[model samples]
Target chain A: MKSKRILDALLAPMVAIIFSVVLASVILMLFGANPIETFSKMINYAATPRSISLILNSATTYYFSAVAVAIGFKMNLFNIGVNGQYRLATAVGALVAGALTFPGYISIPIVIFVSMLVGSLWAGIAAWLKVYRGVSEVISTIMLNFIAIGLIAYLLAPSMLGVQTAENVVGTPVIPESGRFPGFSIPGSQVPVYGMLFLAALLGFAYWFILNRTRFGFDLRSVGQSPSAAVASGVNVKRMTMYSMLLSGAVAGLVGLPLLLGAQYSFTVNFPGSYGFTGIAIALLGRNHPVGIAFGALLWAFLDVSSQILDLVGVPREIIVIMQGVIVLSVVIAYEITRRVKVRRQQDAVGKATAVAQ
Target chain B: MRRVIKIASVLFAGSLVLAACSSSDEAAVEENAAPVVKVGLAYDSGGRGDGTFNDAAAAGVDRAVAEFGVEVNEVEAADADGTPERAERLRLLASEGYNPVIAVGFAYSDALAEVAPEFPDTTFAIVDSVVDAPNVGSLIFAAEQGSFLVGTIAASASKSGKVGFIGGMEIDLIKAFQAGFEQGVKAVNPAATISVAYMGPAGDNSAWNAPDRAKTAVEGMIDKGVDIVYAAAGGSGLGMHQAIAAAGGSAKGYWGIGVDSDEYVLPARAEFKENIVTSMLKRVDTAVFDVIAGVVNGSPLTGIQNFDLSRGGVGYSSSNPVVSAFASVADGYAEKIKNGEITVSSTLTE
Candidate 1:
């Protein structure tokens, strides 16, 4: 039973991936390309060290976003505001850090603290509305996303935090060199692998350790499983909800750090939107497990990187778009089918054990 | 690994091309020296089909294809990953031996900065921004120079002194348009109030894509008794044209000045042709084609190559019948700018 439980966990994602590939193959066939040859070409393309490096860099970013979403998912609190939270956090973080030239030891910590604080406070608004005003967090968070956009827009004005450093760019001033984390470079790529890669790994381990080995995590999970049961067990449901939200938002704050510190050195106008929403899809794909989320991120990154080769091959980019959509849909579908079968199998086992006792 | 994939895909795609043509090159043995110039263009936010600057850049590639017979691979940027994705696109093109790759917008500045150093052998050209790399060429236009002419036309065509400027984002490039337009509006009428508003803030791609927001902004501008609107808002400028056309157009004394290529003639803007008084023409296609042509002739334009009024790289389009009445007046200012007698400020005073 233990081996079978593990098998089901592993087999589900595998089956979904295979299903997605088959669907993609049919689409490729319609496009007049041999799916096997195309996919094999992509596999060859992915083998390069440069491609691997880029995949890791992309996965590093996705991991932060997915983990942030997963935290709220684990608590049954849908904090859809992760996108707004991260964006606002980085904007404020960049504004402050961009203005001040301090030692790395001081400035780095300042950036991290400022980002988490702003992210936490922004998310706390929705939590506050939910707890006191009886407003649904879903509606509140979505609205806040737009509001956050407006707020960032205002801040990005030249009269405020914005400084035009290039022809078409208006962004916060560059972070002082002393404050930046000089990341290591990989072979065969000019772009440095982000120093935040180590930080993401640390975040993953901490997520696992805290959720499985800590008291707060247990209460949080209990509240997620059943509010009535948790209320009977002395868990403060509202407080737990607030805690989960704040924590999720804090993690979301780290999403932009990889780009900010590693590559661009500042948050510009095109700092990449929609990362927060992609996190939701990734978390679902990974089943919210830390390790699972890591693999899901890498796989998604792999698909993105391969699209470059696929672009060169003259395939319609929409075919890759379809494959991505299909994979996410299959993850959800396969998860449901396996979950039902598992529940029935457990029920059968319990019934047989009772019959043997009788 | 990448070389292997590129070669394999080329062969594979080549076979398909041969199959489709029916009578073309099945006698293929030119693998040693294909002799064709392969041009790679990576377009910015609006991509190829936006019918704005991107489409103008596409026109440049189309011209290069027609005149020089260069093989082209066009890649469009998705806004999701910003810098890294852009860098990867350039890297892919350069590594695949696309000798002279072109990035369509100023947004490619940072991406080119990173990728240019890596592919020292590949010549790169980016429009609207400069990167100080040995192998990279910067094709910058005097947009403000062009905008100044349109601004004079807007003031000349307007029944009311109140004019408006709508930018996609509050960035330096778009701001220069605002600056030049303001000067020209002031050049005509010093006391004229030029209402300036942008669709969104900088750093987000949606600023260029937000037509609804632009439409609302222009509606607000029209309500303020403004008679003419000039927009450098890329795809979102279509919203401005739509609004101006809907709000009584030239019949009600409302006009919109276009940007990049002539908006009056673009199929996408045909319905709004009556609304477009004139366009501030920035010949992006000419710049793109020039870069490709230079590479073909082995004199790749390197460093800050300014395309200005003197070079006829920037001008005012007299496509609308309304602009014909004001054409010579606008052209006089264009001549002065071309001679440096009338210098336009690229910086906004307000």
Candidate 2:
């Protein structure tokens, strides 16, 4: 029985991947390109040591973003505003860190702490609105995102928090080198692995441990499964909702730190966006499992990095986007089928045991 | 539930078997044919639709295709990962046997420097910045010289003593435009006041097409009694044209100076033609064409190819009849700039 459960868990994601590849082959053929040649070239190009580091760095950022979204998912809440939360937190934290000239140990933690605090506070507003004003979180969070963008735009002016550095670019003042996170060089590659990759690993472990081991985690799950049952069991549903949202936001805040401290050292106008939405997709694909999310993030990043080859082969790079969408859909369908099968098997086992007793 | 799972597993297995059983059909090779020279272009941020830089470069490629019958493949930078993606795109073009690869914009400076070394045989031409390499061509333009001519035109055309400059981003290249425009305005009318506003911060690609924000900026300038506005804001410049056209005071001599290509005759911008006095023609198309021509002729296309007033790389467009009246005067200044008798400041503070 134990081995069967493990087999089912492994089989579901595999089937989804196979289905996605077949669907993508059809798309490539439609575009008048050979799918076998394209996939072979992609695999060949992606296997390099340099490409591995690049993929790992991208995966590290995606992993954190996905974990943040998964926390909200566990409580049956959709936190779409991870985008705004992370950007605002990064901007504010980078601005503050730019003024300080402390050592790396002190300054890095301070930056991380401030980002988490700001992210939590921003998301706390949505939680408060939903709990007290009877507003749906989906609408409130989306509205808050636009408001945050406007506010950030206003603050980014030269007279405000922004400092113009080069022609066409205005951003927060530069953080001193002493306070920046130092990246480690990957063996046999020119690229360095992002220092915050360790932080992602730590956060992934914490996510799994908290959800499986803590009383608050149990309360959060109970509230998600059924609010009335949890109420009868004396769980504070409103409080659980607020806590889960805050936790989700705190994790989201760390999404940009890898780029900020390790790479850019300041929040430039070119700072990447849309990571929050990507996180939601990763969460759904992984079925909100911490270990599954790590693999999901890596796969997503791998496709993105490898798709540059298609551009050379006279094929548009958007084919990867189509394939990613198909994969997410197939995985969701496969998981549902697996769940139904498991339930039927458990019911049959119970009936057979009762017949033996009679 | 069990029945559904069984059906799903069967379907999944069936598809895999079908895919595996499919035989590979090899493409037939033809006899040796004439080897045609292929040119590759890697566009920055906004790519071809950007009415300013990239579009000008595309025009050059289009011209070459019409004239020389060469093949061209174009790639664009991915929005988020700028440097790595750019380098990869350049590398791919080189690997695919495209020679004399053209990378549009100064953003390709680092990418070209890295990738050009790896492909020592492929000729590379990068616009807006100089890269010191053996097989690389740096196509740069003297934007200030052209901008200075339009600045003079704007001052001459404005009824009010105030003119405005709306830039897409407050970067060095755009600042160079401001420097020349301000100097030209002040040179013609010493008492003229210039108001400058940028659309958004650096690194934000959306700023180039931010029409609504640009409209607000231009409207505010109009409210402040400015009768002339010069926009170097890419697609955002269209927003300024829309505002001026909708305001409809062109009969009172309220004018706009369009940047890059001639916006006066653009189909989408046809309604705003009357309001547009003259465009500061930054001939990126000419530069792009020149390099490809050099490659065909077996000439070394290396070092900085400067496009200034003398070489017709930059100038004032006389597409509108109303603006053509001052052409002789603009031409006189262009000759002086070409002769080194008049020098335009490339910096705002200068």
Candidate 3:
């Protein structure tokens, strides 16, 4: 039974992968593109030291985003507002960081703390609406996303949160060097891997430890599995929901920090947006497992970096997007089928055992 | 599950045969002797079909393909991707043996800086932003010069003695447009009240594409007695024109100035055809074509190539009949501008 479960676990993803490859190959052929050549070029480009570092940096951001969504998922909550939470947090965080002149340790933590506080504050609103106002979190969070964007749009104007940079590109004033994260070179490449990669790792470890080993985590999961039962069993369901939602939002707030402090140093108009939606997909693919999420983020990042080479090879880079979508869809279907098969097999074994005893 | 796999494999086998059949067309292209020069165009977030800046770049490449027979590959930046993606696109172009890789946006400045050093032999041309690299060609336009001409038209055409300048973002590039427009309006009618407002801040590129916001800004200006509105806000200009058309329109003497390409005859802006007085012609197409020509002719264009009015790189579109009334006044300014007699400031004073 144990071996069968293990086989099911490995087989589902493998089948999905193979199916997606075949489907993608057929689509490429229909488009008159040589999929073999196109894929080989992508693999070759991604194999480079510089490209590997790029992938890792992208994966780090994706990993954090996935973990943030995973926290909400564990509670059966869909916090779509991660998009707005992170943007608002980063904007406020950048402003706070820019005003301070503290040392690296003091300022970085303050910036990160402010970011988490703001993110939690925003997410807390959705939780409050859900618990008290009886508003669906999905709707409230999505609406909040737009509200967040609107708020930033209003605030980031020159008279508000912005200062004009060179060539009319207005952004937040650069943070002091003391507050900025120091990036280090990846072995042989000039490209500096984001120092906050360590932060992502640390967060991933925390996510695993807290969710698996803590009492609060138990209440959160109990409510998620069965809210009515948990309520009868003395779990504060509403409080658990609020806690998990706030925790998710706090993590969501850190999504942009690595890029903000490490590369941009200020929140420019182009402070990377839309990681929240991508996070949903990564979380779904990872099935809320920390290690699974890390792999999922890497795979997503790999596809993004690799597909860039498709444009060079005279193939549409959008093929990669299609492939990614197919992989996600097929994997989901494959997992569902495997789960049903495992359940059926377990019932069959029990039936046979009962018949033999009779 | 077995049956599903069997059907999928069979379908896959059928597609393989069909795919093999389709490969013949591409095979024929591969058989051709390699072209002398290969140009790769890396478009900004708004790639082709934008009917504006990117379309203008595409037009230049199309012309190059027809006239010079140079092979061209075009890549667009995804909306959600950032600087690293831009750099990766450029690197991909360079690695694939594309020469004179032209980046269509100012956002490519950082990307070009990173990629240019790694591939020193490759020639990179970036529109809008200047990078100090030996191999980089900065194809910057004197949009202020063009904006000045449109501003002159707005001053002449306005009945309310007030005009409006709706910029996409409060960035320096867009400010250049505002400065020129404001100066031109002031130059013609010193007492004219020119109300200026930006659609949004610099961080969001959607500011340039947001029609609703542009329309709202235009409506606000019109309410305040501004009869003439000039939109230098990329795709957002369409909304401004639409707003002007909704408010009594061109036949009723309300006017809008278009930007980038001549929008007077563009099918997309056909409904607001009469309302468009004249477009500020920032000839990105001419500049792109010229650069490709230079490359093919062995000059291999490098450094800053400023497109000003004297070289026909920037000017007022003469497509509209209403513009004929101000032709003489506009001509005087154009001649003076070309002759270096009247120096137009690109900076916003005040």
Candidate 4:
């Protein structure tokens, strides 16, 4: 039984990968592109030092975004507002940090604290609506995403928080040098690997530890499993929902810090948007597992980095996007099939034991 | 079971967003024999079919392809991908032997600055923004000079003595256009009230992409007795054109000034072309063609070569008949600008 569980775990992902590859190959041929050459080039690019650094940097942001969504997913909550939460948090965080001067330790933590506070507050509105007014989170969160974009659009203008930073660019003023993360070289790449990479990994560990080993985690998961039963067991399901939403928003606040601190040192009007949607995909891709999410973020990052090479090889770079969609769809289908198969085998094993005894 | 359905629905919505945003058409161009000079155009977030900035850049490359027979490989920058991804695009082009990699927009400033130093042998040129590298050639336009001509037309054609300027972003590049337009308006009519407003801050693509906002601003100005409206907004500039045409074109004495390419005759803007007065031609196509021509001719034009009015790199279109009435007045300023008699400053004094 133990070996079967292991096989099921490994087999599901492998099957998903093979299915996506076959589908992508057929599409590539229709576009007049050689699938073998395109895939080979992507693999080759992935092995490069520059590609390694780029993937790690992108993965850092993706991890924060994924974990934030995963927390909500565990409760069956569709926290589509991670984009809004992070943007609002980062913009406010940067604005506050840029407005003040402090040492590295003092200022960085304050910036992070402000980010979590703002992000939590942003998500709290949705939580309040869900618990009190019976508002569906999906609808409210989607609306909040637009509100967030409109808010950022207003805040980043010159009359408000914006300042001219480059020839044709305006952005928030630079954060204090000491307050910024001093990223280090990763050897073989001109671009330095973000120092926050370690933080993202630590976050993964903490998420695993807190969700698996703590009492609060127990009540949270129990409510997630069956809210009515948990309510009967003396768990305040409403409180648990509120707590998880806050925690998820807190995590979401850190999504932009890697790039904000490690590279740019300020929030430009062109501050990379759309990671919140990518997080949803990663959360689904990882199946809400800590280790699984780490691999998922890396794969998504890999696809982004590898696609750049496709254009150089005279192939449609969008082939990577197609492959990603296919992989995601297949994984969902593959996992469901595996779950049914495992259940049937367990019932069969129990039936044989009873028949022998009779 | 419900969870499965919910997940499927979310995936469907996500794919729809992807389909709407992705520009995957017009894939790869295969050239059998290696051409003498290979040009790789790294388009900004707008990509190929954006019908605004990237399309204008492609026009120059297309002309180069026909005349120089140079092989071209095109790559587009994805939205919100950050600077590293942009640098990677340039590096990929350079390492793969693309000689003169042309970055289409000012947003590529930081990315090109990083990658140009790594490939010292590769010749890189960026439009609109200046990158300080030995091999980098900044193809800047005297936008202020071109804008001055439109300002003249806007003032001469305006019977209400009210004009408006809508800038795409609050950046210096667009500001130059604003400054020239205001100066031209002031130069012609001292009593003219020129209201200026920007869509958003610089580096925000939405500043150029938000047509609804531009339309709203234009409507407000028109309600305030403004007869002429000029928009330097990028893709969404069409919305302002639409608003003007709907408000009653030449028949109602409403005139809209077009920017970048001559929008008077563009098929996309043809629906409202009759409403368009002379468009402020920045001549990006001419500059792009010249850079490519230099490479093929073995005399690559380097350094800060300002394509100004003297060389005919900047001017206005007289495609509309209404513009003919003010042609003599606009041409007088054009000659003055070309002869340095009427010096236009890129920076706005007021």
Candidate 5:
């Protein structure tokens, strides 16, 4: 029975993968490129050692974003403002880090903590709006993204960050070199130490533990599953909602640390990328499970990294976007199908047992 | 049912094998052809069809295809979310025989650094950022040089010596433009006050993409007794132009200066052709096309190429009717700057 359940658990993702490939192939056919060739090239490119490093690097941000989104999902909340949270956090982190003259050991952690605090504050505003003003978090967070962008731009502009020279255009003063995270080199390859991957994994495990083992986790989940029931059980639903959003923002803040401290070491206008929104897809694909999210992030990263070959094969890069959309759509459909199938099987067994008793 | 499943799995596996074999065969055919030059372009967050930077860069690719008759491929990143996606696209293009890939924004610097060394044979060109690699060409522009000219134009044309400069973001790059414009305005008309307001705060630089907000900001500037606003706000600058056009009062002759490509005659802003006082032309297309041409002609410059006013790579647009009216004044300033008579320093410290 356990083996069957394991098999069933695996089937949905497998079917989703198969359906995604088929859908991609159909689209490729319409574009007049041989789908087999294109897919093969993509697979081959993805399997390389350098590609593995790239995937790992990409997954770090993706995983964190997914965790942030998943935390909100657990509270029946949609944190659409992870993007805004990340932007605010990164700016705060970058500015604070840039201002400090501390050694690497003290500076990096302080920067990261400040970033998390700022990110939480930004997200907490949305939560406050949702709880007090009866505004939906989904709308509030989305609107906050625009406000964050505007504010950041205004602050970074010449009169504030002290535009030094032409060479440092579109960036804050470079974080002191001592404050940057050192890169670990992989032997026989140019890919640097993807230390952020391990950090993401640790955070994922922590998230999983907090969600499954702790009292706050239980309260949060209970509130999500049934707010009325949670209220009756003495859980503060509004407080839990606010806490979940704050936690979500904190997780999202970490998404920029790797880039700010490890690679770029300075804040650019669009430095964090779109990890916030992409994390939503990753969270859904993983079904809000930590381990599942890691796998989902890896798969998404692989597809993203591999699809670069589409251009070389005379296929429009937009097709990869279509494939991504199809994959997400198919996975959702497959998940629903498996769920319905399980419910139907249970009903059938119960009906048979009743008939026999009669 | 199990037998059917087995048969389907076998068919799928067969197709996979066939696909792999055919792709290899096609790759061999491509290899056998004339040294196929693969060029990869990592667009800005707006991606292609933005009718702005990405579109201008893609126009360079189109020119390469038409002029050199080389095989070309472009990757349009959906948004900033696709940084690694851009690098991956470069790697894929490299593996598939695309040489001399171009990443079109400063955003791709780190990604290029990570991906460039993996394929040493593949030459990379990144616009607006310096990546120190033997095979990489960093295309940077002296935006300040162009901004100086436009600032002079704005100052000379303004009736109210109080001109305005609305920027998309508050980065050093935009600051450089602002500084240069301020300097030029001071040089031409020292009494002219330049009120600067950026669209966003510190880090979130989405001001370049939001046209409505840009229009509002420009309108706000105009309301404060300022005319002839110079906008370096990317697509958002379009809003500034629109606002200027709407406030069609003769005494309040609000003019706008466009950035990057020449927007004075672009089809998108046909209505504001007359309202455009001047534009700071960064010439991204010229740089891109030149590099692609170099790749074709076997003379690609594999180091930093700084394009300034002297190179004709970055300058003010002389084609605009409004700008042409100030031909003698523009010429005088241009000659003075070129001949070391007027020095335009890029650093705030200077």
Candidate 6:
């Protein structure tokens, strides 16, 4: 039984990868580029030390984002608000870190914690709206993103942060030097800092523990599978739903820590990127499994890093975006196929057993 | 059992074939002739095709491709928060033989600092912010110099003694433009009152790109009896222009001043071209093209390249046919400003 389970686990990802490659090829051909060349360039570019570091850096944020989205997924809830939650958390954390001067060790943790709290709070607002007003999280979260932008903008302006120089640029004060993450050089290359990857791994393990080894996780999964069943089993479905979203937001908040506390140490207008949306792709790609998420994050990082190399090879960088969309679609289709196949086999086995018993 | 095993083996074999097929095709391409110069462009959040800043920078890249036949790769960082991702993207380009990577906007400054030294052989250029790296070239514009010229125009054209300055973000860079505009207005008409309102605060810079907020801010200024408004905001400037059009020939004839590359000529603002008193031309495209030109000619400029009004890098747009309507006033001030007769000071220290 154990061996069969292991085989199934390995086969799933392999199948997904194969499916993604085929889909990517069709996309490349549509764009009039050879699929083989594009995929090869992607792999070769990701093989380098610098490219590896870039991949790791990209993955750091994806881990948190994937886990956050996955939490909502487990509850059969779609938390499209990860983007807003993350933005709010990052803005608040950056403000807190930039405003107060603290020692490096203390400040970094405080900033990260504050970010998580702020993110949770932001998500909780939507959860509250959904629970009390019967408003859908999807709609509320989407609207909240615009509000988050406006609120953050107001706070970062001269009247609030007061960090602007004569240029009237809206950005927080630079975090004190002690508060910044130190970069460690790789043995032979000038590129430094691989610490964030370890941090991501640690977070991944934490996510796994919470999902599989804890009561809260069990309740979340039970509720996701069937709210009526969970209620009959004495689970507080509404509370669980709210908590799931809050927890998801908290996890998503961690996405900005590496960027904010790292070498830059300051929050700019473009600090959040599309990490919130990209996290959705990571969660979907990983099938909301923690281990799968880690791999998905790495794959995403690889694609992003490799796309730059594609530009060097005379290919448009936008092709990378097309490839990402293709990969996601292909993985989803492959998962559906696998699920159908498994169901059909199970039905066949059950019918044979019934005949033998009769 | 044998049937199941056979199916599994077939699936595995199919996967291997797929992977192999993709890898082999790439190998064939590399075996061919090497590509020429590889240039990577990292655009701002608005991305390329926004018909704005990113598009302007991409135009310079496209020009390089056409002129020198250099292989160009362009990526849109997509959002402000994606600087690290964008930086990582640039580093990837460097690793793959893209020698000179150009990151458009000051937002990439922090990322450039972390990534530039890692690839010392790879040269990086950042527009708007200065990075202190040997190989990194910081291309900055003297926006204040241009703002000063437009401020003069606004002061001269306004019937109301009250002028307004609408800024996108409250940054030191944009502040410089505001300060310069204020100074220029004061230089021409000492009694003119200049009210300054920024679209966003210090912590968030989206106000620079928010057209609605810009329009509201301009409308508010106009409501308070300010006739001529100078906009240092990017896309937000479009709002200011729109607000001017909306207030057409009202209590006080409203005039708008444009900024960043020449909004007076952009197709998006073509309708309001005549309403614009003048534009503070930042010339980012010209600077970008010049760098590409340098790279192709084997003499890529390094270190900081400052574009000031004195060098014609930053200044007011040429007397547009629309400006001809206000020609007498514009020509009068142009002569005075050019002949060392008027000094517009934007710096707080000055």
Taking the candidates in order, what DockQ does each have? 0.24, 0.17, 0.23, 0.35, 0.21, 0.20
| Model 3 lDDT tens row, B286-327 | 888988888889787888899899988899888988799998
Report how closely model 1 matches the true complex, as a DockQ value. Answer: 0.24
How does each model score on TM-score? 0.90, 0.77, 0.84, 0.87, 0.79, 0.77
Worst 10 residues of 4 chain B by lDDT: B1-10
Model 2: TM-score for chain B = 0.88
The Cα error of candidate 6 at residue A55, in Å, is 1.0
If both were scored by DockQ, which would come out higher, candidate 5 or candidate 6? 5
Better of 2 and 3 by TM-score: 3
The predicted structure with the larger TM-score, 1 or 2, is 1
What is the DockQ score of candidate 2, to 2 decimals?
A: 0.17
lDDT by residue (A1-358, candidate 2, tens digit) is 9998778776878887888889889988997889999999888878887678778888888898899888887887778788778888888888978988999899999999999998888889999999999887777877777666666666776668888643345678989998788889878766677889999999999988888899988888787777899999999989998999999999988988887887666775556766787787777777778889999999988998887777666565667766676677677778877777878999999999999999
Off by over 4 Å in 3: A10-12, A95-107, A150-165, A175-188, A333-358, B1-34, B64-68, B155-166, B182-200, B211-229, B240-256, B265-276, B293-305, B336-350
Report the C-alpha displacement of residue A310, candidate 3, in angstroms: 0.9
Q: Count clashes in each candidate, considering only residues at least 3 apart in sequence or on different chains.
A: 2, 7, 3, 0, 20, 26
Per residue, candidate 1 scores C-alpha lDDT tens digits across A1-358 of 9998778788878887898899989988987889999999888988887788888888998999999888887777777788799899988888888877888888888998899889889988988888878887768987888788888878887777688767667778888888786677788666678888999999999999888899998988887778799999999989988888889889988888888877887777778877786677678778889999999999988888888888776765556556666666667767768767989999999999999999
Q: Please give the distance, in angstroms, between residue B285's alpha carbon in candidate 5 and its true position after superposition.
A: 3.6
How much does candidate 1 score in TM-score? 0.90
lDDT of 4 by residue, B140-234 (tens): 89999989999989999999999999888676788899999999999899899998878875445567787889888989998999989999988
Task: List the candidate numbers ranked by lDDT, top first.
Answer: 4, 1, 3, 2, 5, 6
In order, what is each prediction's RMSD in angstroms? 7.5, 7.6, 6.4, 3.9, 7.9, 8.0
For residues A1-358, write the lDDT of model 3, one tens digit per residue.
9998667566766677678789888988988888788778888888888788888889988998989888988888888789899999999998999999989999999999999999999999999999999898879998998788768867777778788543334567878899898878878666778899999989999999888899888888787778888899999988988998899999999998887887777776666778887787777677778988898899889988887777666676666666666666666667768767878999999999999999
| Model 1: residues with Cα > 4 Å off, grouped in runs | A95-107, A340-358, B1-35, B189-192, B248-254
- In order, the first chain's TM-score in every candidate is 0.95, 0.95, 0.95, 0.94, 0.94, 0.92
lDDT of 5 by residue, A1-358 (tens): 9999778767777888888889878978987889898888888877777777777877887899989988988888888789889887887788888888889889978987898898899999999998989898878988998888777767676567734322344657778888887767666445564666778989988998999999999999898888899999999988998899899999888888877776666776556546787787777778788988999999988887776566555576556665665566566668777777889999999999999999
